[model samples]
Every structure is written in C-alpha cells, then in structure tokens.
Target: MFPKIHALCAAAACAVAASPAALAQQTLPAITITADPRADRGALTVPDTEQAIADIERIPGGVEVVPDTQFKNTPAQTVKDILERVPGVFAQPRYGDDARVSIRGSGLSRNYGNRGINMSMDGIPINTSDGLVDLFEIDPTAYRYVEVYKGANALRYGANSLGGAINFVTPTGRDAAPFEGRLDIGSFGYRKAQASTGAAGGPWDYFLTASAQSVDGYRDHSDGKEQRASGNLGYRFSADAETRFYLNLNRIRQRLPGEVTKDAALNTPQAADAEFERLDQQRNIDSLRLANKTMLRFGPATLEFGLFGVHRHVMHPIYQWLDYRVQDYGGFVRATDRRMIGGFHNEFAAGVKVHNGAIDTDQYINLTGGHKGNLAASMYDTSKNLSAYFENSFFIRPDLALVAGGQFQHAVREREDRYLSDGDQSGRRRYDNFSPKIGVLWDLDPDWQAYANISRSAEAPTFDANTFATPTSSDIEAQTATTYEVGTRGRRPGFTWDVSLYHARIENELQCLTTAPWSPCTIVNAGRTVHQGIELGAEFAVLESALATGDRVWFNANYAYNDFRFDGDPVYGDNRLPGVPVHILRAEVLYKLPGGFYAGPNVEWMPKSYYVDNANTETVDPYALLNFRVGLAPAKQGWTGYIEGRNLTDRRYIANAAAAGVATPASALFNPGSGRSIYAGARYTW
Candidate 1:
C-alpha cells in the first residue's frame, strides 16, 4: 500500500519540480522581505507567553509552544514536570529522570529511554546515532521556550519520525535580563540553585547559565544529583546574516529502583527490590556538546545551515555492568523562498542532513554496585543517518493553501563483536524509508483556521529495541504507519482552542518479548495495529468581570482520548495494546490578584484503568491527582517567590508499568507514583 502511494507522491513531486508554471514563477521579479529573527512577533504581540502561543496558532497543523514562565517559577524537575497539562504528550516519570514520554502512542512499548521520537536542542538532533536518547541531558530550566512539532508538522526541523520532534529554544542576550538567580527546595530532599547572565556589546553577545540540583527521591534507593552548564555566543555580520555557537556540559549520577509487583507498588510504594538495593545500581553520565547555527537572508529567501558534535560517556550498573563512550557528529542545510511566484503566493523549503556516530561499548557481570566481575560482552557499534526533504505550499486563494512535502531517509546500523569468548553477534542492518505528507489549510476568518492532512511515517528498530538474547533471532522488522488527521485552531472573545482528530493504520509494530527472567528482552515484528485518538486544548477567561478591573480568572485544559488496539493479530485478536489509558485529562484554574499574585489548582486525571500487557491479564486502576500553586510574578518585584503542592490527596497509584509479551500477573511490572510533596522557590533578577 505504501509503495504505490509513495510512488505517486514521488511522481507528483517531480512533476511539480519541472512544471513550467513553477519555473516561470521562480523567475519572476524577486522582492526582499526582512525582519528580526527573534521569536518576538513585533507590534502585533502581547506578553512573551502570549506571543509564543500565538505563534503556534498560526501553524497549519498540530503544533504548540510552551512558555518558560510556565515552569521556571515552579519546581521544574523533570520532563514530566516541564510538560504537564500538554495534550497529546504523555510524560510519566517513574524514578528520577526516567520517564515514559510518548506522543500519539509512539514508543509505547519501551519502558526505558525514549524512541520513535526525535529530540532537538536548538534545532540540533539530541538522539544518539542509534536513537538512544537520555532525558537527563535535558535541563528543564535551561530553555527559554519549548516548541512541539506534532507528527508531520516537524518537516521544518528535519524530523520524520512517527512521534515528530521537540525543540528546546534557548534565550539569547538580545532581550534576556542582565543577571538572574533562583533557588528551589522541595520535599524528598530536593534542592537546586541556578544562575544566568546575559550581555551584548556591539555585534557580539553571549548568554550563559549554570545549575546544580539534587534529589533524594520518594522511593528507597532512588537518589540523584546533576550539574549542568550551557552557553551561547553570537556574532552579527551586518543585519542580514548572523551566526551563533553553543556549548553545553552536563554530569549526572542517579541510582536505580527496580520495579515492584502490583500489590507492592500500590502498598509499599516506597520500597525497592531486594536485589536492586543490594546491587545499588546506578546510571551515571558525563557529556559535552558543541553546535552552531547560521542564518542568511537574501531578497525574500533565507538559507540556514549548521554543524554539531556530542561526546558522551556512560557508566551504568543494572541487570549488567555497562560502560560506553560515544562521539556523534552531524550537519544540515535548509533553504526557504517565501516570495510570491507567478503572481500567486507560494512558499518552498528544502533541506538535507547527515548524522554519523560510533560507540565503544562493553558489558561485564555485575559484582554489585560499580564492581565488574569479568568481560561478558564487548562490541563497537556504529550508526549513520542521511535525509533529504522538501516542502512547498501553493496558495489557492488569499486565505487558503495546499501543501505537499516528503522526506527520504537512509539509516545503517552495524556491530563489531570483540568478545568472541561469549559469542560473535556481529552483524549489520540497513533501512530506507520514504515518508510523504499532503494537507490543506483554510482560513475561516482572521482569527480561525482549519486544516486536514494525511501522512506516512516509518521507524527503524533501534539498537536497544534489537537487544535479542538469542543471536540467531536478532533481525527485527521496521514499523510503518499511514495517518489521517484534521484539526482547527482559533481565538475569540477571550477564548482559545486547538483540537485535532487522527487515526493511523500501523504495520509491523516493534514489540518487546521477555521470555526469561534476568535476561534482556528481544524485539519482535508485531502484526497489524490501529491507533486512533482525539486531542483537545483550550483556555477560557472564566471571570473577566468589569467590576474587578484588575482581577481575572482563567482556566486552561488539555485532554486526549486514545484507543489503540491490535488489528486482527493472531494472538491478541483485536485486544487493546496495553500501557496507555483510555482517557487522560489535565486542567488548571488561576486567579490573578491585581498585585502580581496568582494562585492555581491543577488536576491530572486518568479516568480509566489500562491493561499492562498484550494478553490483558492484569490492569492498573484509574487515578486522579490534585496540585496547587501560588506565586508572585517575576515582573512584580526584584525578588519573587512561589509555593507548590503536589499530590495533595496522597493517593497511591501506579505511575508506570513494564510490559511483557504475556507474562504471569505476578511479574514485577509496576512503578509507583510519588506521594504528597511540597516545593518552594524564589528568584531574584537585576
């Protein structure tokens, strides 16, 4: 099915490329349009946060921008903490920074690190060459804002993964405060200190931040500490060209708390497995990254290109002792022409990127903690990726446009076994995929827009996903999907909403099959599956009475209705794939008190229990959590403070579960959520 459709798209793209109309249009008179590249949407803008949100509303599809202020004044701990209340995003933390963050059911089968999702730092890919990405490298407070490109909307960022991409944009010296400092103390022995400085002189500018944090965690054997520093220096060559260099360094040391059974997870939620406690397993990392981005504008056209390098060292002791040193390098180039063509409005963008890396990896028997017994396995692993993509939108009218885009990706994975004493698992795999997308955006008026699109996405199995215990059965098939979606976004009379409905037909979903205890799981090419859902985000000015000139009450909400199931699989036979709940909702209500004081209550509710495995033999019950926060706005005074309370009801519930093929109900699969906690933070600005 995909082959035929892809062929059609390829032919159409060729035709469009050679069309006389397009050629003539491009040869037309070129007019230059220039403006500041900063996120600020000058003139027609409100506050910074509002401007960010407004930018998202202008996109034709599912996309969003989260303001830094939303979490900076609060206890910004982990990805889960940073992405709360964002619909279509499921970020559930089990321990420390290990969270299950999936969008649109992508990476639902992985209980560990992320996959099927592309992550970026200032538009640079954050995933390893083989798709091994660590959330701990992401400092929740380091970003000025976060941009979410859902699914195919990620074309601009060079991502074609099923889960799309997330870009963390940092603040620069242009408008940042000269100096800022913040301190946070919270329950579970949590504490952090952060400071940042920004300066600009002539054509040179720099922004830098340093942060240190530690947490005792809510569970036994779970403790962690991290130190991070990030900086960027920029130089402007005249007004039409600019270049920036970035540097980031991070060091993290975190313990591991093995999973517990359902009963234990709900009862003794704070207990760790006896084996994990004795081993004192830990995951530690030291990493350094450098990157650059350059943008040049020329008469209604722009060119952007960049290069990046990352060096990371990891020492982990869990099921086995592991050590790794990885070096990754990449570069990209993109060009955009937004001028009118053939007297009609047209926008075209094209780009290509290449990323390659190798890792020196070794595994040893865990003698307990950091001690290694003997060489168990050793290998040199390498991964390479190359992608070419293009997008062009033709305005059919002044208020509507038709968009076409696609990406071609080639990926290679290879392993060289050095430990023949155990077994020679050396092999290689190559994968190629062509993902294409088409859509239409129509303006209903000046304040509203409607859009519909269909796209194809593919995912190659990652090294972690191919960790087969049996070397003979190491080949895992890639996953593919065809998705159909429609959505709308608009604002009217103090109200804003973004909603979308989507359905996907998926083939060869990669699934984990744990056949033995104390052994690494193997990946399988699971049969057909279907993913369907609705995503809704809304904000309402509930109380804007004129009587209270300065007081206002606003409510914000995000909800997702997910229905994922097997599509006539031989074993599961239409049973729902386990892990994600049927309904997830997050909401908040805030009242502004004229004096720069604001208070809000937030709720995260999963109204339905979900199965834990393919067999659906066991389930996790529904849960609801309430949290409250009161804070003084940063603009209110030189010194501002906030107090936040989480899980006020202290409800016991499972936060995440590990899935097996169809194991016994007694398997250790559950991880408990954190208990009641309180955090207070203060910031000083000059």
Candidate 2:
C-alpha cells in the first residue's frame, strides 16, 4: 500500500486530489488496510479502488483515479460534474447529458460527438468500432471509480488516439453494500433516483444497479429523460481463477436546442434556435451491452481475456431524419509478469485487441414535429480494427525505473451506398501505424515522484468524417503526432500537487474547415499543427483549527494553459485554434468541521476570450461563474444529504463553441451556459 499523505488516510488524500468536490470534507482518520476483510478478494478480476490507484501510479505519464465517494454529494448527472476537477481535462455541458470534452487539445475540431479519445468500461470498449462516443449512455452513479490515462499513457488499453482513454470500473458484490438508494432534485424540474444491491456467497458474487432521471432543462427544447441498468455476476473456481459476466442497458431521449449566435447566446440565453424549434429536433437511443471476462494467476504471472458485444438503435431528427442500427463485437487478451530479471526487479505486460462492427444507416427528409418524409440516403458501413501492444518497467535502482512500450494497429473502413439519388458515394480506406514510447521515473521519496516521456500517437478518421466530409474522394489521411512531456507529483504536510508540461508536433491533423451556413462543416487534413500546454492541480490546508472548534479550512485549485495553432497554412497562416481558450482556472475554499459537515464556494474562470474561426476574425467573450455547496458527507453507515447552488450570479456566458473556417457575428456557433440554479440530494446505505 502507498504511504499516507497526512494524518488522513491515503485513500482520502488521493481521492481529494482527484476531485475538488471532496477536498473540504477530509475528516476521516487514517486506517490500516491489512485489517480490512475485503483485501483478500481476487485482485486480477476485481481489485478495490486503493489497489487501482497504486497500479495507476506505476504508469510513467499523466493518470488519475477518482473514487465515486468524492462526488456523491453533488448532482452526479453529467461527465462534467464528475471530471471537471481533473487537470488537463476540458468538459463543458451543452445541454442535458451532451458535453464537449477534450484532453490536451484532443478533439478540438469536433463540435458534436466524441473523437480522438477512447472510453471503456471494465476494459471493454464502449465506443463504436469506428470510434464514436455517445455521452448519453454513461450513468455517473453506476461507477465504483474512474481511471483516466492522458495521452500515450493509455498503451495498456491499446489506445492510439492522442487523447488517450478513460475506464469506468464497477463494484463487485464482494465490496459493495447490500442495499443503497438515493434521490436528487434540483431547479428547472430536475429529478433523479437510483437503487443498487449486491451480495457474495459460496464463491459466487453479484451486483445490480438501476437509475432513472428527467430534466425540464434551463433552455427551450432541451428537456431530456433517461434510464440505465447495469449488473455483473462473478464465479471463482479457486483462489487464483475467476470469471465474470456483465450486462448494461440504456434508453435515452433528448431534445436539441441547436446552436445560437453570440448575441443570442449572451442576451437571450434561454431561447432555442428558431429553425431547430420549428423542425422539432431531437435524439433518441436504445442500447444493450454484454461481456464476459476470465482471469487466472500463475505464481509470477497473470492472464486475462474478455469478449464483448453491443447492439444499439438510434433515431435522430435535425436537418433530416436519421435512423440507424449498429452491432459491434470484440475480444481482448492480456498477460502480466512480475519477477527478478538478472538480479533486477522488472514488470512486463502485453495485450492484443480486435474490434469490428457494422452499421445499417438511413436518412429521410424531415417533416414538422420530427416526422420522417421521403428517403434521402441509405448505406451499410463496416469497420475493423486490430492492435497489439506491450510495455515493460525495469528498475535500475531502488528509487528509479525505466519504462518502454509500443503499439501497432491496422484499421479498415468500408461504406456501401444503397441509395442512387446521391450518386453512390461508396468508398474504402485502410490505415496502419506504429506508436512507440520511452520514459524514466525517479522516486524522490515515498510521497513524491517525477517523470518524463516521449511518445507518438495516431488516429484514423471516423465514419462521421469519412462520409460527410468527402463526397467524391477518399483521400483523407490519418492524423499523427510526436509529443514530449515531463511532470512531478507529491504531497507535503499541508499541500499536494500534480503538474505536467507537454509539447506536440502534429502532421496531417484533422480539421473542419467550412463557412457554409446551415450545412455540415467539411473535415479535412491540415498540413501541420502544434499543441502545447501545462496542467496543474493543487490543494492546500489553509488553517487547521483557528477557532479551537476542531474545524479546518482547505483550498483547492486546477489550472490549464493551452497554446494550439496551425504551423503555417496558405489560407489561414499561423492562426490560433478556434475551439478552446488559452487559460482556464477553477478554485475553491472551504470550511469543515470534524463531524463531516462542509461548506465552500468555487469559481470557474476563463481569463481571455478565444477565437471561433480559423481566420481569427470572430471570438467568443470570456466569462466567470460563481457557485457554492454545503453538505454532510456520507460516513461509515447512515443517511447523508447536501444542497448546492450554481451560477449564483446568473452570468450569461458562452459555454461551448464550434469551429469554422471563417465566421461572422451572425454565425450560430455558440451554446450558452445555464443560469442560476439550486440542487439538493439525499442518500442512505447499509
């Protein structure tokens, strides 16, 4: 087990650093892990959260583990609500469950849907085979903990995207409570409820959870409702062997307000776009996932394998009516060995993954009230991907280790157009690439460490870009980048910090460059670009007990500095990237009593406005938000509750913006943030 950060438990300190929402409530005393009965469970198939954190620390780059306890008191409804405290991550909600998320400048060109990143659950890919993520499928309350691997550090998962990967780990019956329930209600007619139960008996374990939520949204035409269910069953043949099965289902419906002009976004922030309201735009989806995994231990080595399948149906109405059905299946195998090699401590791991999927797609003319008219397009799309990766860490001395790894991937994309009206836009493309990484880690002490790494990343275009961006050609190339990074993390008596600096040189970067109104922007490959930034996360204990009342004061902050630009293009020259700002800062100060009650105020600030067009002719104005929370955190066993307020100042600011080649003041490209609101919740467990 890792050493404790202070008088508090290592688990509490690490969890606090990962989520600012938990910073002020650190009143739990340190406890020894050996006395815990759950420690003897199978580590390979289902390691506890502390073990997960220790494993993540072995990686020589940016990574974090966030326990669900850290955000339990808040309205854990969206990714932004749970992940916003992690440095180097950008998550801004547009409306309902949809958010524009990116890491270290990844997916800057994508305004809707996810790209340049990989998302998984229990090591199984949640993204479609062609690399698209639907945020609506994730239920924040279902995860036991979340693991974030930024950039090339995600080699363990065979991820090749520049943004790396995030894995949501679920609890097993051996570690969960027998029964748990929660309810949350907030402004704008928001409501959510969840129930879960788990148990273990005679080498058999099971866990199940279900949730339902609805929101009348702060924006017109943006209301949504969703339902989710997840469960897992595990069987142990012996102390060293186990197998588990998982099932997940989701039903979601969300109305789209669409984008608004800067003036409308800042002035009439609550109004929906006229065209979108007239057309009654909406998105609805039904999806199911099933998987099985097995693990076996062999003294000095462990082997794991798994297979997963997903089925989804989507109905979307915007400019047109889109109906699609997708079926995806894949499998992975991995092995890890730890032992002494030539009298030196060494650890090695290797894995291979294969993912394939097919989609039946249809588009029809749109009628009023989100009804379908005549058929506009029909196609069958298929994707195949295969990747193999390996990593090794060799200890040179008691306090130093050298790490090296690499991944090779082959991918194929094929589209068969069945509709003749669009003149058969069928096409085929293949991509192959190898990425390598090298790093050095030095332990300054038990509580501090420093590391440096150089790595490469590559990403292939998804079907979204392959189909809509190029109607008559199939020439878009893969995006690739080489990056150099260095960082340090440590904890002292009263402070903890994690910081990293990185610079990347990219080639054939994917970008959307179009100025047409009411049409999809065309994605293209840029000649060259650069992404560089600093990520900083820190927390400090301000006053231990100034009033002699056993109360404490804490301060927590996260700051990201981004500098992204095109190297030199004939049309745009060396202009700044359009989507993200240069500086983002979030900070909070809180007062806590020894009994678990805490109160705090926080702020989110963008110091300067950023451009919205590649030409740098138009910009989105900078803004700041003020919020506060007061809650009694959950203890060993009992009922807990919290009240939270957001945007207390009712600031009218742009929350998200899309990229364009050139734009005017009239361009409808910005999404407004929600106004002042309040939320409250209660939970009980036994």
Candidate 3:
C-alpha cells in the first residue's frame, strides 16, 4: 500500500511541476515588514532556509527547524514520532501516551520528571523550575512549525540551558485563513478530529481551534482519550507592532498499563493483561499567555521588545506514580537592538525574568494487610534571572561572513518544603549561579558554512527530591554543562544536508535511584557524566518532471551516534546510559502522483543495549521497524483519504525497562512497544 501511495504522489508531483498552470502558480510575491497595515499588504512568502538561518544567527549555538511540510502529510501520530526522525533527538515512551525526550546526551539521569532541557510554546515555558514538562499536554496539530536549539543557544529562553530547547509555533489567523477541519482514523481503534476558524477584521484578528483524539492502544491498559482547545486574539496597532493573547486548555484520561518483565515484553509486546487491578489516571491542564511585541526604527537601527506571561495548572491521580498539583505564574521582558556599526552588523539583546510557583503533592504507600500510609508534601519556589547578550555579523568580501556572540547571566533560586508526615517542615534552601557562552560562524560560500560554539547551562533541583526527608538528601546542587559544537547547513539544486559534532562535560548530574526489587525509586544527585556525539541528516529529490502535471519523488534520512558515560565516581557504574540508544537511523521516500495521489515508506532502526531490571539484571539485543502509507485526493480542493500500516513486520519488542520484580515479578521490568496495526481515514477541506 505504501509503495503504491508513493508512486501515486510522485506521479502527481511531477505532473503538477510540469503543468504550465502549476508553474505559473509557483511564483510568490515578496513580503514587507512595516508599521502600517497598508504597507504590510502583499503575499507573505519566505523560504524555509531563510527562517532556519535567522534562527541560527539569533541563537548562540546549534539550531534546527522542521517545517510543516515535513510532517503535515505523514502518518505520524504524535510529536515524538516527528522528532524521532531528527538526528540527535530521541523519545523514550514509558507507557502509552507518556514520553520523555532527550537530546545530544542530555537527560540521561532524569527518571521521573523533565530535566536538562526547556520546552516552550509561543515563548511560554512549558518546563517548570523543578525540571518537568508533560509531553502529553501538547498536540502536534496546533503548531505550524517546530524549532530546536541546542546547548547555549537556548540561553535566551531561561535556565536549564545545557541540553537545549524546543519551541512549537502555532499558525496565525492570516496563515490558516477563515476555517479548516480534519478527521483521521487509524489502526488500534485510533481516531482524531480537529477544527479551527479565524477572522481578520481591521486591526483585530481572532483564531480558535479544538481537537479530540482517542486510541484503543497497542498494549492493554494503554488505551486513552484526550481533548484540547486553543485560542489567539491579536490587535495590530501597526504592521510593526502587535499585541497577542493566547489561551490553551487540555484534558487527558488514561489507564496505566504497568511495566512488564523482559520476558513478557520480548514475547508479547502487544499484551494488555495485568496482574494487579488496572490503575486509572487522568490529567488536566489549563494555561493562559499574553505577549506584546513591537518593532521600532531608530536612526540606523531596528529595535524590538517583547513582554509575556504564562499561567499553568496541572492535576493528576496517581500518588505513587505522580499524584500532584501545581500552579506557575511568570513573566519576562526582553529587547533586541540591531544596527550597523563600522561596516559590521551588530545585534544586542537583554532581558530579565521572574518565576514563582507552588506545588502540592501526596504519596500513598501500601502497608501490610492492605493498610495505606499517606504523605502530603508542599513546596514554594521562586527564581529570578538577569541576562545580557550580544552578537555581531561581519561581511568579509561578500562571499564570506563571520558571526560572533556572547551572553552573561545571573540566576537566584529559593525553595521551601513542608511534609505532613511527622508534621515536619524543611528549611528554606537558596542557590545562585552565573553562566556564560561564546560562539562563531563563518560562511564559506552561498552553499556552505562552518560554525563552532562553547556554552554553559544549568538546571535546578525539584520539590519532591528536596522536600522528602529521605536518607538521600534532596538538597542537590544545580547541574551544569559545558558543550562545544561545530555544524553546517546548505543546499544544492537537487540535494540539501546538515551535520554537526559535539562534546559536553557535565557536573553534579541528578540520578534517580529505585529500591531494588521490592521498593519504590527516589531522586538523587549523581556525581558527573560526559556526552559526545555526531549527527548527520539530509534530503534529496530523486526524480522530477516538467512535462507531467504533478510528479516528484524525494528521499529523507537522519542518523546519529551517541557516546555517553560517567565522568567521575558515581553510585552506578559507568554503564552505557540506559535509555540513550548509541545509534539511531531513520529514512523515508515520498512520491506524488498526477491524479492527486500520494504514498510513502519509512523505516526506523535502533541498536539496543542492556535493559536494567529492578534487580539490575540486563536484557540485551537490537531492534528495527518499518511503516507504510498510501493516500489519494479525489478533487483538487475537496476530499482526501489515506490508509496506513505501522510495524508492518509485526515485530514485538520492549520500549522501556525498569525494576519490577516483587510486585509483578513475572512482568515487573519491561514496557513493550507496539505490534503491526492498520488504519484508514479521510478529510475534506474547503
């Protein structure tokens, strides 16, 4: 089916490219940025490469952007599926909808909550100071594009700058138009529906979108349902200045299919039976964001300023797993000034941020004879940061350009925790740190560039680790990393590619320790670790025709090699990082057909290593998977349908590993991936 789809799409793309009408429609008008609405009138079109370069130049380190065109028509189910195709990025799915993301060797020690990286949507930080970002709260359908900035490049966002940053940007009223809707259904009882509408009248423009999705799931106890709504209201004072307000709401109801043992995972990756009563989990999140951006022309310089705030609330029902509630409110103000000085173009930016939040969590412990012990934990944390940064680009002999920049930041954090057990309260803890970064880029020519940078980043300790009066103290020091990276991006007539190499050394990393076999796990501060790797990615146009109506064929691939290990004495041996796959590779080929048909085939491969059990036992082997998709558009501006198959080989495997011997000894240490599944869906756009 996938091969047929690809052949169809390839034929369509070639036919369109060859058609005189299609060639005529391919020409786009230039866009102008201005302060007057009248002056902003024109077709707003910009190449993906231009935006990618702009992001790279503005950031202090490595950065990558994935355009909407890359995944809009793919058979991907979640953001993890999209990101996994990118080199140096990996998603670790615990069970069903829960997943943890890691980049360039970072997030190796984080067991429960998000750590080492910052995630944001439209400039609102999704990661709490305690180092956790709930990936389940995000829906990929809402965003027009995704951007990833690695190492020090994330400094502009906030702390936890070491691993990197991910930003999801939604489409505006002007980009998506008046109304749009889509419905999708796939294998395993999967179904999704989404709709959005927007109107632009004079100076005011409003947009709203809603979505609902459900799946029977690949494994038992993994089935789930989700609903989400988002809105954006903006007032354009002028073309150069605008104020926008955003609101996001999400609810997820799911069942926890506890982890299985290595044997179970390997033998029955799609099994749903549970030894104990199945646990049900539900999560709710409501977030509001307001931001204002203004651009001003000052003599030979352009000045831009932005101010924004966010409010987030989360509730869950899994005490031992993660039954907690939190409220976060914060604001940031930043200004960037760009000007030409002494034949060099210089850009300077400075900002200050304040974050204050409170979290209350409860833990239940099962005692003998079905008795239960309840523990209540509460915490208050506040963080303030001040930073100043500058970057300069000098054009040397037209064909060659040099870019350089630096940043200085000062941060302070304070925390206090109270525990109900023993009616004890932990004293307030205070911490402060200073971090810096520097980088340089050289454009060898129009199609080639070389860049290198070394930056420092840090992450604060979380409340659970700090408040619980366990033998292992939670007063862990902040973790820091110094990373050096070199990379390049370019394109030829029929091919494009990007590659990078990086090395990082971290201090005082946080490692979670679980009680062997019968006991639960806890968070702890480990000594030191080192992460180094190489990433290579590229895309090529395999076939093209100008005489046909719409016929084209393309291939895309990504590969990464990661080498991670302990740098100093730590509780655990210098074992290869548990979840970080040493080698990851992905490739796909897509084609468009003349009759508006499309098809594609994609493959993902990962070499596995030791799977750690609660008793520290190891499960060793490797895994590979394949997927295929086929689709057709009955009319140019009407209905489109698709059919997709996942795990075509029906190979069974484990997606996660943890200690689970005592409770469900036979299946306590593994979480299986999925099996071969088929799905079909259709959409109508007007």
Candidate 4:
C-alpha cells in the first residue's frame, strides 16, 4: 500500500512539473523572519533568534530552529510533532497533545507532567510556579517561529535548568499584514477557523487574533474542543524607542474515554469498548498574559527592557473519579544592551523572574457494598524563585566571535498537605545554583561556520515529584549536567545542511520508582545518566527542471541519531531511555504543477524498543508508516482547495506510553497514532 501511494503521488507530481505554468514559479524565494519584536534593518532577512542560535551553537551545547515554513509544510497539529522533526529532540506524548519533551537526556523521569524543559511564548514563561507546563494548552497556530536552545546555551533565559528552553514567538503587527483568516474542516469531524488583522497608523500599531478548533477524535470516548484569543498593541515613542503590550486568553474542554488494553489497541485501533461508557473526564485551562517591552537608544548603544505577568487556572475531573484544581500566577522582567566596544561589537542580556501557585485534589472510590464516597486529598504549595543572568556575545574579529554567560538562581518551595481529618504535613525547601556557559564561533567563510562550547545547566523537580516525603528531598535538589558540543552549518547553490555532535553527563538525574503494590509511587533523584548523539539535517533540490507552464520539482530529507542510557544504574538495568528513539528519519519529494496543483509523499520511521509500564513491566515493539497528500487549486481570485491522506499504510502502533506501575494488569495506555485517515478542505484568502 505504501509503495502504491508513493508511486501515484510521484506520477502526479511529475505530470505537474511538466506543465507550462509550474516553470514560472520554479524559482524559490529566500526565507524571511517575521516574529521579531523590534523592527530594524535585519528584520527583512535574519531572524531575531538567529543571533541567539549562533551564540548557543558556539557554546559547548546543541540547539535547533524550526522555521515557520518548515512547520507549515507538515501541517503540524501539535508542538510535539514540531519538536520531533528537530535533530536530537524527543517528545513523549502519553495522551492527545500532552507532551513531555527532553533534549540531551535532561528530562528522562518526567512522566505525569512537564519538567526539565522551560517553555515560553513571546518571552512569557509557560511553566507553572512548580516548574511544569501543560503543552496541550498551547495553540500551534499562534506562533510564527520556535527556537530550541539545548544544554547550557539556555543560560541567557535564566533557565540554567536541564532540558533547555523552547521559545514560541507570535507574529507582530508588521508581519501579519492588514487582514487575513483561515478555515479548515477535516476527518473525525474536525473543524478549525482562525483570523487575524493588524494595522499601522502613525506611531501606534495593533494586531488581534482569534481561533477555535474541535475534533471528535480518532478513538471512541476521546473528543475535544478549544478556543483562543490574543492581541498586541505597540507604540513608538521615538525613532529608536517603542513599547508593546500583549494579551492572551485560552479555554479547553476535553473528554477522556479511557485507555484500551494493548491487544485492543493493536487489533482494533478505532474501536471503543462498551465498558468505556462509564469512563468520563473533562479538563479546562484558562490563561491570561500581559507584557510590555521597550527599546531605547543611547549614544551608539541600544538598550531594551521587558516586563510580563501570567495567570493560569486548571479545573479537571478525571474518570468522574478524581477532581483536581490548580492556579498559577507569575511575573518577570528582562533587560539587554547592545553596543560596539572599540573594534568589537557586543550584546549582553539579563533577567529576573518569580512565580507562586497552589494545587488541590480529591479522590473517590466505588465501595464494594454499592456505596460511593469522595476522599479529600488537598495540598497547597507556594514557590518563589529569582534568577539574574547575563550573556555577552563579542565579535573579536569580523569573522570570529566569543560568547560567555552565567546565571545565579535562588528558589524556595513550601508545601502543606491536609488529608480527611488528618494533621497537615508541611515541607519547605530552598535551592541556589550558578550556571555558566562559554563558546566560540569562527565563520570560516560566507556560507560556512564552525563552532564549539561547554556549558553547565540544572533541572528542578515537578509537583508530582514534590509529593513524596523521603529520599525525594524537599526540592529534589537540582538535577545538574555538563555538556560539550561542536557543529557546522552551510548552504550551497542547491544544498543546505546543518549537523552537530554532543556529549553530556548528568548527575542526580530524576527517575520514577514503583513500590511493591504499584498503586502509588513517588519520583526521586537517585541516578546518573549520559547522552551522546549526532544530528544531521539537509535539504537538496534533487530535481529542479523547468517544464511547460512554469512547473518545478524538488526532494528533501532529514535524519537524527540519539544514543542515550543510564550510566550503570542498578534499578534501570541497561534500559534505553523510555521515550527517546535511537533513530528518526523523514523524507519527502514535492512538485509544484501548473494551474495551482501540488502533490507529495513522505515517510517517517522510528525503530522502537521496550518501555517500563506503570507496573514496572517491559513492553516492546518496532513500527513503520508512510503518508501521502495531493491538492488542486483552480486559478481564481482567492479560492483554493486541498486533499490530504495521513498514515496511508494504516499501520497499527502505539504513539505513547505511561509511567511505570501506573496501569492495571493487561491494561496499557496505548495511544495509537492516527490510521489511514483522509481530509479535504478549501479556503478563501483576500
């Protein structure tokens, strides 16, 4: 089936390439950066994060960027899929769109919530006061670019923590244009509509966007819907100074029918059992953000400062059995200075942040005598954190640069738990650490560069990890790591490629341990781990031929290899990292035909391995799948249509796994990736 689909797509692309209209559109345009907060000479070309990326790559670490064009090509539904395509980055999705991301083996023990990685949108931190972010709450369509800085390079953000940082940047008024909107409907009763408009008049500029999406889900009992709105307003005070205000709000409602057994997941990926009727769950997340940024020019130097605040609320009822509520509020401020010293240019950035939050939960059980009662298990945690960091990138020579930075963080966490008629259990913890990074970049030539660096970072425990009493410590101490890396990037006439290799050693690594009964467990920092890997990515215009009607053809591919493991640990016993695939490869060949016709076929392969279930039992498997798409658009004013088919092979495979000793016997939460599904849609843009 895969081969047949590939062949059909290939033939159609070939025919389109041979048409007369495609030849006129064969010439590819240079990429542009559209997400920067400041408007300057470089705004039309290099991205604001480009300097950040260069500094990170040169630091003894690894980093990657997924531009807007690359993300759009895949039609990504979630941030997880976007990260998986980046070299050396892994995303473990235990359920729909809820992801646990790890880079350089920094977040191996994150099972139930986000840890290690620090995620942010437009410079506003996303992690709760307890140091976790629910990735599902993010709307992928809202961001124009994503910057992933791994290892010590993340020190600039005061996130000297493990797993590094991910910055999602939204479009500014200048990039979005006057007005635009999109509407799409697809399989599983999926529907989505979004619109944005921005205008610049005099010294004031404003942009606003709203979007909504709903899906019946691929499996029984799993349906979801979401709505989001965001706006930005900026004013220029002077020729070189401007201030911008931002606002964002989101709401999500979902139903969890419950997980299926392994056999059921494999045999009937689309079927829902009758017993699932009794299972019901819903989650709601509401978030509000406000921020301001200003840029000032003094002499030959440019000074920038930003202040922001975030408030998030989570209300959830799981299985009608467990109810949970959480609220988080936080704020931060950052400042940076860019200037030329003597013959060298330098950029220095620093910031401080703090957060406070609380969580409360209740559990219920069905009594054997047909009686049902709820048990109160309430907990309150207050956390205050402060970090100050400075990063400087100095151009020692026209083609040579040196980068160095460090951060000092002070964090305190206090928690109190109250059980039904039981005395309160209270704990308080404090942590202070200094993280530093240094790197060098030698631009050997115009299109080629060599870089190297070494850096130190840390990761804190999550709320789940904080629940434990002993051995877990109060804050799980900070998980620390040292990373050494080198890499290169270049672009030739028809080829563009980037590759890097890194080695990292982590101490006090976090891992989950299951007790004998397997009904309850705790997270602890009890082990050491090592990660080494090579990431290679490239795109080549395999075939660029002009045919009738201005058609063109091209093919591209990317691959990544990761070697991660526990360093002679007693408990894990030579087990591979649970969610990180040793190898990942993606390839596609596309052609633009005349008369607005396009077609392509792509393949993604992951050789899987075993993962410890919630009960500490191992489950093993390996799988492969293929996908294809073709679309047509009549040459008209503003109307276009497209048809896409995913998982063309209809292969049955698990998309994610649960924590050790979490699921019942014979019950593994095997969230299957979508099967051979098809979607057709149309849009009108003016």
Best by TM-score: 2
lDDT by residue (572-608, candidate 2, tens digit) is 7899988898999999887776667778899999989
Clashes of each: 0, 0, 40, 23
Pairwise lDDT winner, candidates 1 and 3? 1
Local distance difference test values of all predictions, in order: 0.77, 0.83, 0.59, 0.62
Supply the global lDDT for candidate 3: 0.59
Ranking by lDDT: 2, 1, 4, 3
List ranges where model 4 is wrong by over 4 Å: 1-37, 41-61, 73-75, 92-96, 257-261, 271-279, 319-327, 360-375, 468-475, 512-521, 546-551, 593-597, 608-610, 613-617, 631-641, 661-669
**TM-scores of all candidate predictions against the true structure:** 0.92, 0.95, 0.84, 0.85
**Candidate 1: 10-residue stretch with minimal lDDT:** 1-10
The RMSD (Cα, Å) of candidate 2 is 3.8
lDDT of 1 at 536: 90
The best candidate by lDDT is: 2
Winner on TM-score (1 vs 2): 2
Model 2 has an lDDT value of 0.83
TM-score of 1: 0.92
